[model samples]
Target chain A: MSVYTPLNEEQIIEILSNYSIGKSGVVDGIKEGITNSNYFLKTSVSEYVLTIFEDDNVNLDFCLNYMEHLARKSIPCPQPIQTNSNDSYILYDKKKLAIFSKLKGQTVSNAKITNEMCSQVGKVLAQMHMYSEDFKKNFSGVRNRDWFLNTYNKVQGELNKENASLLDEEIKRYLNYDCKELPTGIIHSDLFRDNVMFQKNTLTGVLDFYYACNGYFIYDLAITVNDWCTNSTFKIDHDKQKSLIGAYEQVRRLKNIEKKEWNTMLRFASLRFWLSRLNDQLFPTDGDLTTVLDPDHFKNILKDRKNYSDKLE
Target chain B: MSVYTPLNEEQIIEILSNYSIGKSGVVDGIKEGITNSNYFLKTSVSEYVLTIFEDDNVNLDFCLNYMEHLARKSIPCPQPIQTNSNDSYILYDKKKLAIFSKLKGQTVSNAKITNEMCSQVGKVLAQMHMYSEDFKKNFSGVRNRDWFLNTYNKVQGELNKENASLLDEEIKRYLNYDCKELPTGIIHSDLFRDNVMFQKNTLTGVLDFYYACNGYFIYDLAITVNDWCTNSTFKIDHDKQKSLIGAYEQVRRLKNIEKKEWNTMLRFASLRFWLSRLNDQLFPTDGDLTTVLDPDHFKNILKDRKNYSDKLE
Candidate 1:
């Protein structure tokens, strides 16, 4: 939600010369994306989003290739605009950068997420999972089980006894309960309601694949359900949940192992976000303008997922 | 460059219900405007910019009427969007808010302001002044001369001997100086490069009229020239100044008094911004996402304008 790199017009024109996207007209810094500085770059041809990755940890190559792979399969995702030299990325002030065709449509906020909208999102998620299988490159998602353990250890002193014990129990649960037979694919692990854009009744675009990596397919579904199917008070709207999962199953039926471990996956997803948000609150990064999401939202979700496991039935 | 208010879908939809702008689709918080919260609202019918005034001093009625007056003359500015009840302003969270038809085109950054571009800006600015003469409402710009004396007095203790004397002398000179016959009208007193938008060679829009009020038009021109014509090292680019002022003369010839007081107006504009920026640095406001512009930029401009007063000829 901030422009880290303030580029001048000459720099923008020089950057555009490396691409076949024609001359740059208007380059407005978009106050979106926490990890990268994003700009809405317009040209005579069309509009493109020029992104400069601020975080050193992001692997630009893998993210670009993955989006390209999905785009090649007619998936509604932002396709990276290749350079004239046929390179996927550019070097700007030593920061890894890329231009992407701006995705049209607006993100449907959680309050606007109807059962039908959830169903659409679920179908799109399934399609992305199916298409991402052929992606040859691999990058492990950043927020893995190890991240949970490390983050919890860092913020353990700050958490109350209840939260600390709950985190410990959840960490042990995820580490101990492993099902290698479960389905796996490239998952948009951060598929929040804010990440998907809708055009009327149709889901026009899916965005922010910075968290994309090989992960349990059912876990990805849980992440989506936790966000899109949850109300402001963190209660699950069962209609949204059923519609989303039912529509997803219509495209690709869940494996027996996935179905058996669905409740556990929901708990795992809830705890993952709760730990990350807690870490952000306790031990924040040096990003000039980073949004600190409330950890209590996911804490409530974790509590609800645990005590009301029967409610999911 | 930040969103102060984060509205959810229901809030946005409810807000749009007050207007006839159709159903809201996308409500993106635009990270512009330091003194107000702004959002780019897209609907099925058209686009509008929603602004929530953060400062209590803003006269909403005067500002709206001034814009409506200019808009009636087909001036290239955002027209205020009225509510279903025909009220221009709405009360949202106790903040005075209004919707304006989103202006087209992109702001030309300082580095991209070519001589011809500056000329176009000058022409449009002159036209705005001409069109705004009949504006009935009166709101003295908050950054008027008296503000300089008050702010400088407030921050004098923090300034060094040399700096304090410079401010004292400037204030005394402004207070003693008399030019009662100079052209005065509704002026866009802060027409910095980022505030004006251009499409190709043509000026498409001018924005941020929150600073618009009854003031010496020459002083407004001086403020603009100080920004648009200054280079990296804060030296006035003589060619840009010549081109801009020359083109402005073609629309509305500068009065003899204006020309005689040109150097004084230049110093006045510099002093006004310097005091304001210094005040911001010294005594900051409680705005959630207020941008603190460097006071040194205007200070340097004042230094250069004083030392090289002969260069303007």
Candidate 2:
């Protein structure tokens, strides 16, 4: 999450010309993401966020448009600001250019993740699912089941035998996930604690909708739980999971099929991310911004998800 | 005036809706101003300064438009951002709202005023004087000659006779200043160290256009020299004054008339701020934001200006 594309004042002003928003007075790099260069834009009127996509793969049409749709429906997320010409994005130096209304609050550090916070996140996540029910756009994440197995194969030779076999074993077990039989809707494919912003333990906004896609509702819940409900030792905190899922159910309850598929969804969530992180480590991008996230943390969670049958109750 | 008007998040958002700058993620009140409410806004792309004029008398047309004009000529001044409707300023809750591009440096503290800095301030001030040559719009400050004398009479009863007499004597001396003879132009009337920003001993930006007005070129130079050249003892640092004036004349040479009137202008420069600050002290506004500035610092400088006839060479 470092600045890969640094912009000057004139460049920033040119970008602001596409909209009626005020101009920036000062700008500093926000060091947190791997895909894009982000700057905090402050004007005399209000504050905003500028996202300059460094990668060609940024799905502005789906992700930003989805955020626009969700924000209009009263979901607590960053709304993509349309350009004065009414486009969700503009091309800047052949890269995706867009700004979003900055959300209130901040992401809680992992150590500070509490059950109450989880409950709030779960509530928001549930509301998001229900709110976007009418949004017909479908998206499949780049790091899905196929990516999991493919990434494992790519990084298999680089890993120790134990870790390699552990990866293969998990991939095989959940390889036959029957998505057609389960309830499905749009899912924020990446709902890690860092993607959520909170004010005084109350979740104020969900951020970084880059990985959002159409998927099993249980999949989103699983991905969220694997991050927020996990303890320091990589085991699920029963109280936190209960708090999260309990609050989620208050907004949109899980179906019977979803309940039966809970543990598998949890396993797949960990397996996919574990493989992805391992792949990134093995084939790291050539940049200073490539923050090598830990792979083994999710590996541990992958194994723990298969410990006993997860009871939704 | 301090933050006489404290705005909450919703009020800030409502104000931002008028223009298209991205919304702020975090806004913190800037603590170093006297006539308006200012905030440093940080969003995702850039930074900006928000000024809400607390006084009903703020001249947005002359001050903002003047800054807009000066900024175009590449003078180190903040340019005002216009609304989508192309208005110079928007009325927020009936108070003037305008955003400016944040300048690059910070105001050099009085203790850190360097000769190099005074030279830079001099060059920029001279450039500003020359650059706005075509800008025909004029602004007369309410804290002008008439206000100074009227305010003196208003505060006469509050003073302990000694301070009052010193003010009256200075006023009577400058009361007959022949404005027709002096070369008049737009002057940044308050070029105090706090109003000029510097980075690494170089002046980067001149701020607070609220006090900018049509006035004598020597008057602006006198104000600049008195503040920049003054020492801790409130006596003029001759070397600093020389550096400032030397750099200034390199851009716009002083006429014989301006050179002859320099000391009188210095005393008047000190006299105006002295009277204004005294009036503020005697009749402090009814708010926690009315930071009491000492009137005697300028008074001491006024006495010192009368000690020696200032020379342009």
Write model 1 residue lDDT over A284-310, tens digit each, in one string: 777744689899999999988888663
Residues B67-184, candidate 1: write the lDDT tens digits.
Answer: 7655533455776765766678789888888888776688876447789988877776776765455455677877766776688789999988877888888888888877789988
True contacts kept of each: 0.00, 0.00
Model 2 over residues B10-86: C-alpha lDDT tens digits?
87777766654444335778888877888876533235677887777767788877876565334557666555565
Model 1 off-target regions past 4 Å? A310-313, B1-313
CAPRI-style quality class for the chain A–B interface of candidate 1: incorrect
DockQ of 1: 0.01
lDDT of 2: 0.76
Best by lDDT: 1
Model 1: lDDT of residue A282: 83
Per-prediction TM-score to the true structure, in the order listed: 0.50, 0.51
